[model samples]
Each structure stands twice: as C-alpha cells, then as structure tokens.
Target: MPTTRLSKVFPEELSEDTIHIIVQRPPRDLEFMPKNKRIRITEGWKPYKASNGKSVDLPPSWIGFLESAELEPDPRKAFDYLKNDLQAGDAINIPSMGQVPKDFGIHDQNHKVFVTEQMLELWEDMRGDKD
Candidate 1:
C-alpha cells in the first residue's frame, strides 16, 4: 500500500509549528555539568555575530533544550523528556544568552546548519541510553 504524506496526518499549522534544523556541526557541551556552571558558560538564545560584523544565524538550540532533560529530579525518567517528547527539528525558540566563545568549536561561520547522523548519535549518548 502507498503511504500517506505527513501533512495529511497532521495539519499544516501543527506541522509548521515544528522547527526545521539543517545540521551544520555536531552538538557542543554534551557532558553532564552542574546547572549553575552550564548557565555561566551559556548565554541563552542570543544571536551569534560573525567577525565580519554580520549576524550569524545558527541552528535551533537543541543542545540548550536537551540540557534540561533531567530537570524533573527523577532518576528513572531523567531523560524521558528527551527520549519521548523531543524530535530532531522541534521548535526551539529559547532566547540565547548572547554569543559563544570562539573556542567552543561551534563558532565556525561557514558551515550551514542541518540535522545530521552525528547529532542523533550525540543525542543518544547524552541521554545515556546507548548500548
């Protein structure tokens, strides 16, 4: 049998609500760090500017969003939010703190952002559910 399009199952508005991510580079800061430390290092959702003084638009803040996966204080389900609710291109409009440091390895101005296999690998690794 032929398969139906995703749009047919979900309305355009609902589908459009999803974020479109084009993986440019692998995720950053996948380590489990203290929230305070993480906050200190992070600038939230601020735009990144290039050395040429142009606003650099990066991909959706999946790392920031998933960083809070275990915020519920439950061990057994520490990563349930990430494993179940979140998808690759979910809408992530959180305000970035400002700009990340150049050494962060995510500041490359040339790479285009999109979803990549490495991202999924990192996601599973971050969740600590890898076999």
Candidate 2:
C-alpha cells in the first residue's frame, strides 16, 4: 500500500495545483516510484543554465503519484484494476514476498519488477546520474 504526505498549502500565494517540495537530496525512490508506463513525469531532473545561474531541475511530484498508488484508497480494487487493465508491459506492483518466477523457480524475486521496453524508455527519460 502507498501513502501520501501533505504540506501546508498557501492558497493565497499560488495556484491550487501548484506543489512545493524541498529536500536535501532525492531519496532512494525507484522502490516507491516505479517506472510505470501509463503515467509519466514529463519533466525530469537535469542540468540547466538559467537566467540566474546553472542549477539542477528536480521535482517531487512523484510523491503524489505514490500516494495515489496505495494498492491508496482500496488495495483490493487497485489490485483488480491491475489484473484486468494491465497489458503491453503494464504490470501489477504488489509486494510479492517469496514469489518465484514461473517455470524456472530457480530464484525468488520478491522485490523485482517486470521490466519492459516502455519501462526502459521511461527510465532513460527521467533525471539520471549523468549530466
């Protein structure tokens, strides 16, 4: 199940949809924000030369998506949606402890995700280690 955190909203100062997040560094997150294909983070972290100076582009919006993924309101219904709606590399991201791959069963991949081409593309698109 996923969780969402809320911050103080200064409605008078900004638009309702605008979110603000500040942190010392990005957390170890692929575990929380998996590279799913249906939704996307159009803008990712990158180096940019701005009018002020050079800086990095970082967005914490994935946190919203995480809470929405609680597997948030109803895990049972969310699981159902994944089972029925996922296709074309889409997957159900449940914590499958002691789960084994079919046929091989050679190794237990409790924390593995089904990697697809789309997932790969999404990974490259996101802000990565290199500039």
Model 2 lDDT tens row, 1-131 = 22233424332554448565644465756555666521345445444444467564544354344334433343354444332433455544554333234653235634345657785556556627657
lDDT (Cα atoms) of all candidates against the true structure: 0.49, 0.46
Q: Give RMSD to native, each candidate.
A: 24.4, 21.2
lDDT of 2 at 25: 61
User: Over the full model, what C-alpha lDDT does candidate 1 score relative to the true structure?
Assistant: 0.49
Worst 10 residues of 2 by lDDT: 1-10
Residue 58, candidate 2: alpha-carbon lDDT: 40
TM-score of candidate 2 versus the correct structure, residues matched by position: 0.17
Instruction: Write model 1 residue lDDT over 1-131, tens digit each, in one string.
Output: 23345554445644556664443454566366677667656745546565577865443364444334533233544434445544565533222233433554364533233445677678777767557
Q: Per model, how many backbone clashes are there?
A: 15, 2
In model 2, state the lDDT of residue 118.
Answer: 82
